[model samples]
Target: MSKFKPEPFISCYGGALGAGVDEVGRGPLAGDVVAAAVILDPAAPIAGLADSKKLTERKRELLFVEIQAKALAFCIARASVAEIDRINILQASLLAMTRAVEGLAIQPEHVWVDGNKIPTWRYPAEAVVKGDSRVAAISAASILAKVTRDRELVLLHQQFPDYGFADHKGYPTAVHLAAIEKHGITPHHRQSFGPVKKRLEQLDLF
Candidate 1:
């Protein structure tokens, strides 16, 4: 049997000094855009790793711990709903990613991003589609970003009990849509999202 090789679009970390960047919550009607950059420890082995979307919540939670434990350095950052509304989700996500990379304890020589569009930062980077599933470092980054965003939504549930944030995690589920239709959007809702934007238009609120 032949061993699988990474796709051309997917760039390796190149030795032990590269960073992986990924973001979560870009499509949610609520919650902040969260991003994570991870530098994996040379000795670490994160097996069965894939994109966070392919993993169950239980699996993601488990990997989150292991990744943090094995990472040489990691940083998580967020662009709030207000920021998202001001700059749009894509830019906000990029902003969050840039912030995460900037905040890392050790700077990286190169960065591997998990999407086709690279962030506007001055660092050298390559964006790979589905990179999170192919690159261990990107997978670790996805896990951390997802886990952090999930925790934030869970906390938001406490403040806005009507939204069921703990369960939906700010996704555009029918239940979440119903909640928005009923209770209207909270301050945490992304005002720029179409559904939330329409609701805000009707209510004439910022």
Candidate 2:
């Protein structure tokens, strides 16, 4: 597992204070879409930063705390299921990222966002393809967002054990789809998603 190094990109931007943004839960059928923005302290470097999806849950959980403690600024934000259904997932994701950046304790001079599209915000920003793997700050943001959302799903699981939210984290896996078919949709499920929509239609609730 390769670690992310943001020095190259940071140097390219002339070492300007910058924030890295990333989001999670876009593919999930339930729960909010969560995003995180992190500004790393160059003087205090952290090791083992990598894409959140590539890290184990334990690694992510550990880094999640380290990031908050060492980062110059970090913020986690989310778009509710209702917001996702209203604006569509892509726009909702952008909205969440925007909110995360806006919520940061310290503003950044520039922003590096994971993926090809960025939010329509005032900050000078660049979208990096596979940024979470290439940039340390982006990787930290990814870890924060993923761990935060996964914990929420675990709580949701307690409320609706039949959906198995803890196991799949609201994703439309075989077990999750089967559970939905058996137990019906919950309030947290994203009705706009295909699987959830289909289930809702079958139940004459959509």
Residue 162 lDDT in model 2? Answer: 84
The deviation in Å at residue 76 for candidate 2 is 0.4
lDDT of each: 0.89, 0.92
Q: In model 2, where do residues sit more than 4 Å from their true spots?
A: 1-12
lDDT, candidate 2, 1-206, per-residue tens? 89544444542565648999999999999999999999999988989999999999999999998999999999999999999999999999999999999999999998999999989989988898889988888999999999999999999999998888999998889999999889888899999999899999998999
For residues 85-179, could you state the per-residue lDDT of candidate 1 as single tens digits?
A: 89999999999999999999999888999989998888888887888877778899999999999998999999999889999899999999998
Residue 108, candidate 2: C-alpha displacement in angstroms? 0.3
Global Cα lDDT for candidate 1: 0.89
Best by lDDT: 2
Worst 10 residues of 1 by lDDT: 5-14
